[model samples]
Target: MTRCRAWLYTIICFALAGLVTGCWDGVELQRRAVVLMMAIDPAPDHPDWVVVSVQIARPQRAQPPSTGGSGSTSGGNKEDRPIAVVSREGRDVAEALQTIQLAINRVLFFGHLQALVIHEQVARRGLAAVLNPVAQSRVVRRQIWMFVSRERAEQVVNALPVLDVIPGMHFTNLFRNQIILRRQYDATIGGFRQRLVTPGVEPYLLGIDGMDPRLSAPRIVGLAVFADDRLVGWLPGDDYVGWALADSQFPRLDLTIPCPHGHGQFVVNVTRVRSRLRVMNPDAPRPKAVLHVHVHGMIEGGPCVQKEREADIQVLSRQVQQVLAKIIGQSIQKAQHLGTDVFGIGRQVYRMHPSAWHGDAAWRQTFPRLRVIVQVTTRLDYMQTYRQSALLYVDHEG
Candidate 1:
């Protein structure tokens, strides 16, 4: 799978290299506006109209060294900005995009597009109007990241970031780091499309809100759940982390556990994971599923675990295991309540028990009532070398 993906990316890069290097027809490269990011929202007034926005890479002119004489500052700070944002509304997504192209001077080029942001409300309405075009169009790469915005997506595409000067750079960077550092994956348009069409599984998108005025990469709110193409519900904030732990493979996550005895908390960076989710007794009525996760982690912080003893380490591992189990349980309960199978449990059921597993509608009813059991085991590593917390001088309680 890994090699196939690598080859697939290589072929795409090789194929699209020409689009970026040269001009389109007779138009100069400088005259074309490279759209770095795009956002879609339901029209403010029109019940069925769509609002689309694009962030174009601002072209900078060569500036001569100021000999303290030339004061050609007509454009003010606008010339120094890295991107430009344009928005327009139309009856549909493709129409809105065409209207935006007419509104801007330069031809709108989407070959270089990096990210797509869809307002949560618009997502709930349905994404076929948006995603259908994206799928058939040869220009936009299916690898672009997709986000469901908690706030108006226009703000996400317009606001510049302090660190990433370029719009959507933060998310692109985070996507790379998520795979490399965290050993996890974020939703890509290609993956989402597959999920959308494949039965027995539902699609989910990473959630964001560009609440910050300065436009740091959008804040991660949670996950936007979907039943087919329309959004069903959300898993607000850290509530999604539990789902992440169960669904993703071998992710290096920082989990904070309360001090076993006292008033402080400790953080553990878990890695080197051995995990799997199995459909136990798929033939039985109301089939049972077991999620077994084993992770080895090292103490990363806090005043707990000051000493390196076998007994103490064992107890600490148990505590971490309990917390992980609780989190997994909560995530499972939330997913079941929403009646959207984000965990791919239904897919597994179909694979194992094809006869018993019916179509999506039948599985949907069974999923909510399905019995799921979570088992987590944690092992603490580097206990001997872990840094001991500083001793605080506590006066005798009066």
Candidate 2:
């Protein structure tokens, strides 16, 4: 009986402890101003300083049912409450953020930050000064998306979309949309910082800019290439497409390539892209990189000669393969010219032959001289009934 009673008491104690479980230092949600996004730009008139801007979400209070409200549309003055974007200048990101905290009424909360925007000038200067402080933060999540804006980071954080008023939702929508479309490159802080410490492979981020001068909306496009922690150059449309395709980031990409006959243009909606980059003779004075990309897509649309029987898709596939090789090859060359190894070819060399791989300085020296051979295999899942157009084909013309 004594033993049974002791066990019962212990069980009761455990039950009480379970009931007492709660955050010991929890703060009420209303007391904290949630930061939606943050931006870093060069401070005006302070070449050595950085301006950090954070967009804080304004929470609307629920009002009681309008007492005999005369068909009023808005719930209240809620629409007037804009996402408060405030900036503070300091020697570095952490100091700037600390200053902002002192000025704000509520404690600045970053547990739910959506994005981090860095200006073009800031990127060119180098990201180490800005990112080091951010990486040290305990609350800031690394999975949040990162972008480099061509415009001032201030403009990106301040601009409000008429269609989407929920602060930072436009960025979220654009980012996720790109993923869904499988057309553009995307970057997250966690992945990028990992590459910072990673061997051989450099880092890249998605870019944002006012694609049109007339529009206030920011468009996500292209890529910001970085050599180690410093921004080197950017890859434009075609180059970005090539990088995305070769890096296995794009599951679907639409391409308009010349027909096999080389006279007219045709289209193919490419999908299931897979790329493998291999480095041969890593120990030699100069190494060779062979990039093999295998893709499967359908002949989407284009000017094609309607053959009496189904056209030869093998020829069409071969043409597509060549075109892809050219596209990917050009992108690789651009990266080499920029002196940034955007492709993980260097990483492969290090992994395949660790002893052969020297330090970064040695690798960078060999990279530009390295010749990359791009081989693409395009398989048409199925072709349309149409094929070669004799009238459109110019066998004898350039």
**TM-score per candidate, chains pooled:** 0.82, 0.84
What is candidate 1's CA lDDT for residue 33?
88
Q: List the residue pairs that clash in candidate 1.
A: none
Q: Give the distance in Å from residue 18's predicted Cα in candidate 2 to where it truly belongs.
A: 12
| Tens-digit per-residue lDDT, 109-175, candidate 2 | 8888888999888898888778877767788887788889988888877765544556477667767
Q: How accurate is candidate 1 locally (lDDT)?
A: 0.74
Q: Which parts of model 2 have CA positions greater than 4 angstroms off?
A: 1-22, 61-79, 179-186, 211-216, 260-264, 308-312, 383-398
lDDT of each: 0.74, 0.75
